[model samples]
Target chain A: MPLFDEKVKTQLVQLLSKLTNPITLHFFSQEIECPTCQTTHQFVEEIASLSDKISLHTYDLVKDSDIAKAFNIDKIPAIVVSDSKNTLKGVRFFGIPAGYEINSFIGACLEVSGAKEPLPQPIIDRIKKIAKPIHIQVFVTLT
Target chain B: MEITFNLPGLETIEQRTIPLDSSVIYDVIIIGGGPAALTAAVYCMRKGVKTGLITLDVGGQVAETSVVENYMGYNHIEGISLVQRFKEQVEQFEIGFLQGYKAIQLQDGTIKKVTCEDGNTYMAKAVIITTGKRWRRLNVPGESELTGKGVAYCAICDAPLFKDKDVMVVGGGNSAVEAAIDLAKLATSVTVVQLLPHLTADKVLQDELSKFNNVTIVYQHQLKAIHGTNSVEAVTLFDSRSQKERTLNVQGIFIEIGLVPNTELVKDVVALNHNGEIIIDCNCRTSRPGIFAAGDVTSVPYKQIIIAAGEGAKAALSACEYVLLKK
Candidate 1:
């Protein structure tokens, strides 16, 4: 069965068309003990297929443990969205980014692909003023 | 994060919207992103006035709903799908948008200063407040302390966390009944504690709720307290008729009570009704001049999506008039 319905797929394709630059989605999955791993991988695959600018790189969580650690992935079904040049944008989805979480996932894809709206100068300056290394985690409901 | 949707067959698109600037003093600034706030943004942008919209998230209460059957255009649509459409429409305009930041404080004057939680302030000539309501808390013991531990408010978001466990849903409204239904599918048991003798939800919702065999509804019972040390161990319920209290074991609790307006920022500036909603006249103007409010945050009769959108348009027109007159 398809993860996205036909209507949703059409809408998602239109949204993905805004991506001017290429963005890579690195999906990590394992078969055992990880119930949502395959589903999350399928999500990444289907979304990547929607746009030519999107590329999916699947990795086995157990067999590719070193690669997963390099990307700072500590859980199964983790997805790392990188820019055109594989530059990390600090965007990570720990679990299945299904349901409403797809909005944020698509947002990250657009942002990394250089289709993001420009932030105001003051807000930009404020972000630059922060000296500490910040890690922000956002949680979304999938029900 | 960005949201992009250009519609199916639109060969052309309008001018693009830019990010709101703190240095620019807009003619009108809306302080929300719900149906009301988004509608106001469209009106303000169409009026050729410099407008800015500051919100934590677009599509407030409407986004969290499961389905919206009476949104005028569609017969039936998912709540998030409708929200996505609303957001896409707003994204097309040239209105200045500041998403993911809330308007923390509002100072009224010729040029009002709307302070966000990030300490950055945006100035405007006329301010339209559309920051809609939020989920009302349980206010009982351990609710605040054990928010993430066990007591959750969003059933759709948190139901998966209580898989195979017992959970209790508080309230008897549509939200409460829906929470019970959501939990009953995954949890071992679902208990609904209603304050009244019967559920206040619609007949359809009550009928659907009765189909779950694992679900039990206790009428004339109210939640007294949530007792837990680390996580939710149990909940204390109070019976009104018997005037007795009993404890029930549950690992999770979903507080599906009603919502309260997000009027903490403008409570002192605007005159509010007994329900803590801003008192707006027919023009959506508040007690103080140069300030307007709309949607669920105001003393509107109906809290439907269409009503909020209409109120937003009125507020925007009123605000534009105020700014032009002041000029």
Candidate 2:
């Protein structure tokens, strides 16, 4: 029934089990002529079934324009994962995070869900060293 | 157009533009609009940091992709589709996306300043450079005229469409070899025309190519012209050593020669390697502070989709951490 096979879903579930906090996956999509939107939904749902901590929330970008406006979601198949505290930590995964980095995305979600920020000793020392709010502007070109 | 988000103690939010030399202060300003810029925007926005992105176009090279089978999720997807999805996600936040503008200059110190092409300027605490590279052209006649008709830069998107048809790959590098091997599996025949005397690809790919009978490797050859009407019909080659010319009957041409880093804007200001690649540390931090580079533009060894996205994520995370320290 799904484009992705059961084996992939099983693997996603296995990864979801290792997560320690609740991750709310907010999916913003449209209905018509939208195949990838459905596919993204299926992937999230498959992963959702693996853990109680993971929840799937859907918002129609066209129908629920207000909600879409709130999240600034203008396209379909956009996902936003937030921790239980309602603070947004992660971002929209453009296209799909498939292949090798999917595992790293899961890791980011787990880290964000835990909502723990431990500053490195060097960074803390650096922050203390600064007397004012320092602004750093970096310019990079594609090479 | 500016949209203001309501936050405590943020009473009067004004929409204004500043000149580059006016000494306006900013926390951070980013240039370019590809994966690196988008990821940086997300990270900075989440930290409740003020950030700005300046660029004329949004998607960069990723926008031209027809099918992204390797970037992840779904068996396949159009390149524009993925970029639109990314744009939608960025729309949710209050990140300043200065569209229709190009950054022309950069400066150092606590407050950095960047001048745009239109004479508008913005200052920031830090800057992240995510401008991706541009694929070099074959420079052969008809290659440009028949681009969409038969010439393509991506193998994954055009390979399937050429099933049972004859295809030609031009280049001596790993990308060309891998594409030829992949096309050999689908097309009727695959001919690799290289400018070098021999294959310059890794030994593993050269050995793998040896197993494919449908593939023919032509050394010391270069594409001189592409013949076609509405689509590609044939390709002309010139022998470098003998100075002789030959023609092959083919319908498609995949140019895998190489890519030129899109570093024109920042070349004079930043330190670049001999190949024009921006040299960065392990964390995607560029030679200059508040400036980070990622993806194919950097001196990273491997150039793959997974590696680019991983580098993009790292650059974003690092930008986020950098902003927190500034605050």
Candidate 3:
């Protein structure tokens, strides 16, 4: 059975039609150790199929340890979205982006495809003025 | 685990909004992302003012709601989908937009300064506050410690993890009853511990919940503690009438008592009511001359989407008047 119904698929197609640049989805998972790995793998594949600009790359957590480390992924069922510049921009999902999180997943894809609005010049200057590297983690939920 | 997808119909847009800048002093800067803020942005933009918006999330509590039926146009709509529409509407204008950043402080002056959590300060001639409410916590023992371990505030996200296990829901409002209904479908048994003698949720929700035989409603009961080491093991409930306490063994507990207004940043700046809601007059003007407030965060008689949107429009016009007069 397909994960997305026809109605949802049509909407997905319409939304993905707006993608301007290519986005790469790098999914890392273990074959057996990760409980939600299999489901999450299917989700990533299905999401990538929605847009021609989106491409998917599957990797085993154990086999691609170095790549996983570079992405700062320490857990299974993780997905990193690479931007148009072919660089990861901290767009990482730790688990299956199902339920309400699907909205975020779809939004991230569009953002990675250069569909995002730019930040202000002052905010950009503040970012450039940062002395040390900073890692920001976000948890998404309704409440 | 059961995976229920809340996939919304995707919306595509062009030239949505401009980036919010700190260098330019805005005419009006709204500090929220829910219905009120979104409506205010549209009104301000249409009124031909250089407007801006700052928020951590665009939807706020409205996004957390499962379904909404009260907002005029549609009989019923998914809360998130409605939020998406509101967002698209706001994006059509050239309003300065900022997301994933919260306004931490309000420095009241001729040119009010809105300090963000990112250590950046934004200035505006007039400000409209629409920061909505947040989920109220039980503040019981083990709740803060075992937030993700087992005690949860989001029932839709965490309900799947408690499959076939016992769980308890606190409160008697719409959110609590809705959480109980969701849990009863998956959990072995569902118990609702409401402080009131009767469930205060809408009649429809209460009726829907009653259809489930596995669910039990304990009226006038208060949660004392959530006992667990690593995960939730049990919870203590206190009965007001009996003046007794008892422990209910459960694997999970959902706290949905109610919501508290997000007025902490403006508590000292604005005149707040006893409940901490920002006090606003008929024009949505706060005690501060140039600062205005709307939505559930204000001392509005009723907290409804329609009400918030109307108040937001009024606030935008009032702020626009302020900016024009100041100039």
Candidate 4:
């Protein structure tokens, strides 16, 4: 059975039609030890099939340690979205991205494809003055 | 409680994007994602002012509600669904959204600066504060310790976790009564302990609650303490008139007394009323120049979603005028 119904798939297709650039979903999971890893892998695969602009690359966290370290993935069931040129846009989802977080995940994909910086000009100018590294981590729940 | 992944409306696969360019300075920064803030964003965008919204999440308090019957246009709509529609409308405009970020502090100056909890500081010419409010706690013994274990704040979020269990709601207001009615459908029984002689909720809500046979209302009783070992097992209530205390055994307790405005970020920057809500004029202008407030966080007469959205429009127009004057 399909995860998404036909109605939802049609809507998704229409939404994905707006994508200007190709996008890649890099999913990191372990075959064993992780419970939601397989489900996350399948979900991304199903979503990737909806748009020709979107593709999925699955990797084993234990076996492909080098690739996982390159992506700075510390946990299983992780997804990283990149642009057409395989350039990382700093979009990362730690968990399955199920529930209400699916909106966030799809939004990030669109953002990467559009490559439009939404920040206003003044904010960009102010951010340039920051001499030191400023790390920003936002905590969010699935609900 | 069973974790169901296929819950309807849980997975929203809508496609939307918020672009963030650190180099841009927004004309106005709205520090919330509720109805008021989203309305402000839409108005600001239409007025050709660059707007940015920083919030921990979209939907705010409305999303936490189960049903919204009072909001105009919709006879009855799920709170989350209403918020989703609001989000969709706002997405048509080009507004920057700093999603999943909480505003920790605010600095009022020529250019207002909002410091987020994630260490990012955003600058805006004008600021509209619509941070809204959160549920107020009982502050009694064991209430804080048993928060997630048994003491829940949102009935919509935790009601499913308490199937066939007995729960107690503490408040005399509409939210408490509504929560009792909502919980009564899922729980075996719901006991509402109000601190007043009569319910302060609207007559319509009172009437609806009266129809529920599983709900028990205790008037003129104050919550003394919550007693439990691992989770909430019972709550002691003191009858104000009789000068006697009684304990009722319940597995879960929902605190819906009222709400506390999220004005701590702007408390030092703007003038606040006795209730800690931001003091704003009819135009939604705050005491400080280049700053505005609307919605429940402000000294608004009503806290309804419609009123908040109207106040938000007013604040956005005022903010646009402020920006023009500065230029």
Candidate 5:
């Protein structure tokens, strides 16, 4: 059975049809000790099939050590979303993007596809002056 | 637990596009994603006012609720599901959304400025602060001393840490009862300490609490202090009716009495009541011109979802008129 129902799939198709650029979803997962790895991978694949502009690339965290390192993936069931030019915009999902997080995932994809920064111009200008690499980790719960 | 392929019905295929003009100032910027904030966004968007919504999470306190039956148009629905519907409706408009960011401060000026924790600032002609309330603390002794040690606010987040250990829940509202029910599944024993003479939650929740085997409900008892050396080991309670005090040996204490308004961001920028709730007029206008407040964060009489939504609409319409007048 499909993860998304026909109604949801149709809605996604219509939503993704307006994508101006293609988006790639890189999924990292491993089979051992990972409960939702397979399901998350399958969910991404199912979502990718809804629109031609969206593509899914699967990687085994254990076997594809080099690929995982390149993407800075440290955990299983991770997703890295990039724009049409394959440039990482620091958009990532650490676990299964189910529940309300799905909206954030899709919103990230649309933002990356459009190649537009959601921040206001003054904020973007201030961000451009950052001289050091500052990593921001936002802790969130599935609920 | 078995991994199921069930898709969460709380999600929608909603997508929003950011405006290409980076320098454009939105007519209104809403600082929440709950029923009130989303309703304001919808109303503002329909009025052709450029709106932006910034929130740490979409559902606010509603998402943490187990079930919602009081909201109109639905006999019963999960809190998260109802929030998803609100989100879907709001996404139909061309409003800018900055999710997963916490608004740290609000600066009042000719154009209001909202500074987020993500190091981004937003400008708007009108601002509506709907950031709802959060879990209220017991404010008893040892609560602040051992927050992470044992006293917790979120049962869902910390329940697994107390597996097989006895825990106590404070408060008699829906959140407290629901937390007791949820903790009973994992904890060795669950005791509920409520100050009221009777449980204030719905009869349905009260009925569900009665079915739990390892749950104890103590009424008319006030939580005087939390007791522990390194962690939460016990809690001291005062009996209001009997004029007696007692202590229950428990490893964890979950305080869910109620919530206090999330008005810190605007406390200095606008007028606030003694309870730290933003003060708003009949039109949802704050003392500061071009600023509005709504939802649980405001000094509203009721904190229901429908009431918040209605207030949000009013704030948005008022904001629209305010912006037009300035033009």
Candidate 6:
């Protein structure tokens, strides 16, 4: 049997097909040897296969730092969901999006696509108000 | 009456049979199988490292979540679904996962030899302890007996199962607070029972919890006993200071008191902090040179899935470095 039931697959496919805007799922995998990245990539592939609007962009974080830097992606297995013109400025989902949360994520994507006004005031304010691109570095000793 | 091998001639002829000092080595020995360990296995195999994972469970506590809301992408997901996805990823990468085996002792230095409960032994040049911790049980009656019915360790894993049901969460930490808040979304009412007078969780979580009208926090209370014959039907708690007894008619209880590190296997071999967490540097190196640890078992702050996965990657990278340097 398939890992996901036919019902779940059908539901997810339906969910993605109904998306109002183009969703570009970007993944930054540094160590392809790392297993989480592989899974993350697979998840992205599954979602991509289900929908025409879903585009998967994978970058080797170790090799393409500039691309990751531009996208504000520092870690591996990080996914950025964007709009029709591939504007990376949207709700960014970190880590794997599996389980019941996938439905909500799909809902959020649909909601955010046509939404001109903020749904959650806090998250919108955090997304809209862009401070200067800041780099943080820290050094500490074990006390 | 047991027979013994008595080779007197060979035993007496101990004329310096040159002992060859040798150590066992592994290409990739993962310490955990949670998101981090399994993910590391996939990475190591993709990088052409002989990968093997030694973990207590496949999904860790994250699997116990009733519903996952904030893990990006999915607005809501069952904990089992997330774990299944993780497991599928590991299997796809051809990673060797030791099911039902716990890494008890790890001897570090030149070579790594790990022993499990089955007496099966493995040698590795690199060792990563992904053995995560277990949630501290309530240790009260009806707690273990009614686990699946109502007593749960994770709200994300089981909250969906309790839709429109009354839920009770024990403990005052961030996990307990978060569980109550998460359950409040699905359940009709969520009651939080805390042993202390005040919550120990961060102010943010406490403040956010206050916003939920369905939530009620009961302070200075301890779970006296869980009641229910078939499934969890109600819970009894005793006021710590007043010693007054109070029972709440509830359908579910999520125990988020705390976690105890699964360092028992390597307790004697590695240095543990006061909390019994394995002591490790930022590089994921334990007190022993060849041995490394990551995830909840280590002393790293923040036990989120993303953070654990990151730490697991660091541990594997560090293990690779140790192998290169030693060789």
Candidates, DockQ:
0.11, 0.02, 0.30, 0.09, 0.11, 0.01
Docking class of 2: incorrect
Indicate the residue-level lDDT of B270 in model 3. 92
TM-score of chain A, every prediction, order shown: 0.87, 0.73, 0.82, 0.86, 0.81, 0.71
Q: Which should have the higher lDDT, number 1 or number 2?
A: 1
Q: Is candidate 5 or candidate 6 better by lDDT?
A: 5
Best by the DockQ measure: 3
Candidates in descending lDDT order: 3, 1, 4, 5, 6, 2
| Quality of candidate 2 docking, DockQ | 0.02
On lDDT, the leading prediction is 3
> Which lDDT value does model 1 have at B19?
76
Better of 2 and 5 by lDDT: 5
- Model 1 agreement with the true structure over B1-327: per-residue lDDT tens digits: 222222333322333768788899999999998999988988888888999999888889888777899999999988888887777777778888888777888998889999986668999999999999988997998899989999999997689899999999999998899899889999999999988988999999999988989999999998999988999999889999999999999999999998899999999899999999999999999999999999999998989999999999999999999999898
The digit string of per-residue lDDT tens for model 6 on A1-106 reads 2234455566666555557667677777775447666666777777678888777888888788888888888777777777767686656666666654564466
* TM-score for chain B of each model, two decimals: 0.89, 0.72, 0.90, 0.88, 0.80, 0.76
Pairs clashing within candidate 1: none
Question: After aligning candidate 6 to the native by TM-score, how far in Å is the CA of B198 from where it should be?
Answer: 2.9
RMSD of 3: 8.1
lDDT of each: 0.87, 0.73, 0.89, 0.85, 0.84, 0.74
* Model 5: residue B223 alpha-carbon error in angstroms: 4.4
Highest-TM-score candidate: 1
lDDT of 5 by residue, A18-132 (tens): 6779999999987563667877877799889988899888888889999889889998889999976668898879877766566677778888889454565455667899999
Off by over 4 Å in 6: A1-143, B1-25, B46-48, B62-95, B104-110, B117-119, B163-165, B185-188, B201-208, B211-214
Ranking by DockQ: 3, 1, 5, 4, 2, 6
Q: What would the TM-scores of all predictions be?
A: 0.73, 0.54, 0.71, 0.70, 0.66, 0.57
Whole-model lDDT, candidate 1? 0.87
RMSD of each: 7.3, 16.7, 8.1, 9.2, 7.5, 22.6
Native contacts recovered by model 2: 0.00
Of the two candidates 1 and 5, the one with more favorable lDDT, higher being better, is: 1
